[model samples]
Target chain A: MSIFLSILALVIILISAGLLFFLALPPKRRSRWGLRPIPAFSELVRVLGLSVEEGTRLHLTLGHAGITQPTSASALVGLQALERITAISSVSDRPPLATSGEGSLTLLSQSTLRAVYRLNNALDLYDPQRGRLTGVTPLSYAAGMLPIAYDENVSAHLIVGHYGLEIGLLCEAAVRNNAFTLAASDSLSAQAVLFATTKQPLIGEELFAIPAYLQTSPAHVASLRVQDLLRWGTVIALVLSAVLGVFGWL
Target chain B: MVMRSPVATAIAIGVGLIVLLGYLLPLPVLDPIRRLFLDWSIILAAVAGLVAILNLFKAHWRKISSSRERDYYSLFFILGFILTAALGLLFGPTDERVRPLIMSIQLPVEASLVGLLTITFVVSAVRLFALRRSWMSGIFLASTIVFLLAGSGVFLTSGTSQVIKEVLAALNILPAAGARGILLGIALGSVLTGLRVLLGMDRPYSE
Candidate 1:
């Protein structure tokens, strides 16, 4: 069983890598891949535009996961979203504020901010203080964010990372302040809270598709396609396993 | 021009493959290397955490000095941090006094937050119905109501209580399945994201 599972894992990885490589190559056809629109993401784009137009700062938070942690994939995705949003709103005097629970994440957020500024040729406007380390712990981080949520200058809140129950406080604070809230987390418990409190919540793998959906980067889009293919493959495997179990074929 | 380091990518890929191979293969040679990497990660995380603490102090100090609207809160934070650190340094972290001091500050605040979470949960549940009236919303509301009733132990009679217990037991399967599915998706997503990082398709560590 172990050997079979290892082989299966290798096969899946090889298939995904091959597909990604193929997609990365220059294409002969100019066809666009179709993805179902995520309402929360669309809402995020709209709110971001409104914030830019109104000159109100948007806030994005990276939850308690530090940049080096295994769970920091969501933080990476958050940075991707940040890069996209900041590129659009680079002209605004009040560039978006990014808060993180970890010092490393704060540094990464600063780097992301600087990258955006450089990309947009607004490097002179970059401020390190915009990317803040609010708190080190989850609840402390949430507590620290309450003030930011309540701050009248912040028009929209986008939180995407690994989080737990403390997300409720942050989301509720935003909701009370009437800020546009779009929250997602890889944590199941946090997702439960987000479903209840956030105006728009990204569920499960939808969080991973944010950059692909927003920017339509070929790599991101291709990765999304590979993920879906793997998911379908997983479902089929599950069904087959169940059938085999019932028939005493195992 | 942005400085893109091929060395960084190479190191990342090397370390990532080492860790991945360590997990998948039962090779003895990779074990020590994996352990070394793990130890390095812990040390790095600790240093990063310390830097974050110092940054927090600097931020609060700036707020206090600037006479911001909530500067008093920053002052309180600074004092609290200083006092706690002083206590921990003087008395040691595992001291009984330190434990109680930490708990006194942490317990009530966390407990209150948890208590607040219940209210937030109900409000959000109701808000879901208001925001999007759909079959999923209806089901969520129904399930929440049923679970809340079961949790409250409102059914006191022996027969009805047993029936309620059975129903609750059955309902547990739904969330368990959903949680498993979410976990699976997260695992896969993490793998893909990690692959992206390893392959240099995503350079999150770079500016």
Candidate 2:
């Protein structure tokens, strides 16, 4: 049993390494892995060019549950969102707006925005007065954000992280306000439930794909490949287990 | 407002130590201290909740007073909040009538508000197709549509529902696997993030 366990572990590691190496290469190169780069918010500016007028405002939220998420994907996505928003907003000549559900998220988000905005020489765009404490309740924060979504005439709403059923309300509000919504989360159950409800949905590991998509950081790319390898390994394991069980080999 | 009052600083330090000791120490002597701090924390949290209630009041009052559009909703919210607060406070949690009142008032109102919110999301989902298309959108669109239809108990109920079975089977596989993967991922991420917070790699807490 110990030897078998070791072999299984070794198999997983080898596959994972192969995946990482394959994904590290650009899409143009031929490799065993086929990792597609998700477009970053920064690329949006380059593609459309910076709309220096009141063209579109991007509203982002770090979902409530992601604050306590074991994996920092929620927070990482939150940071990425902040960086992307500020970078795009700076050149676009519009203040990228954001709202957060948790107190900690609100604080971190604001800080990230400030840091990026300062780096971009758009310090004035950074609202120094806003703090982390948005509100205590889930629906209350939703209620608070609705007016901002409406009044800001926001052009795009990008929601990332772990969310709940109540998030649908926020999405709906964005839709009603004529803003395009892009939401991504790492939870399967929530994704299962929310996919039907959201105008834009991101399911499963797709939420973690943002960092790899934008920074093309080796770590991010490697992590994403690791996830994919892990997923496929589990699938193969399940199939083998089922076959063995059918043959009375259990 | 003297700059950084010493007494306030001392109190903060004292509270901080108590909280730390409560979390870190399991010694018998510290148990009572921990319990006392726990009780105090609850009271403080309730007071904090009171402050939140005040903020809510002020926000709604301004809206109503200014006679803003949809101000009527604020009035209803205020009334409901007040009613719940009055019942919860005056009768306390043990009040026999409180449950019924809560069910009658809180249940319906919260349900309606949340329902309205859900309906808006449905409308958004319907209109989303006109917006953009990408793999992310594709996954979101497929998942959402299936989730809603399945959750509503409108699918796989009739005899001629091969489509529902295929959809449900596909959806079910991802969720279970995704749930396991996500749980593991979250556990690892939380540990790293907590370390970052503790080590001050991520700190908005300080200026």
Compare the candidates by TM-score and give the number of the best one: 1
**Error of model 2, residue B40, in angstroms:** 15
Against the true structure, what is model 1's DockQ? 0.51
**What TM-score does the first chain of candidate 1 have?**
0.93
The lDDT of each candidate is 0.81, 0.58
lDDT for each residue of candidate 2 in A1-61, tens digit (9 for 90 to 100) = 3556646644644455455556656656754443674443344444324333656666677
Query: TM-scores, in order shown?
Result: 0.92, 0.60
* Displacement of the residue A167 alpha carbon in candidate 1, Å: 0.9
Residue B76 lDDT in candidate 1: 84
- In model 1, the clashing pairs are none
lDDT of 1 by residue, A26-130 (tens): 556545568886777788888888898899988988888976677999988887777777777878867888889987788778887887787777789998788
Candidate 2 structure quality by residue, lDDT tens digits, B41-141: 56664564455456556656666877445466678767877887888889996788997867776457567778886676566566555655556567767
Candidate 1 chain A lowest-lDDT run of ten: A24-33
Per the 3 Å backbone cut-off, how many clashing residue pairs does candidate 1 have?
0
Poorest 10 consecutive residues by lDDT, candidate 2 chain B: B198-207
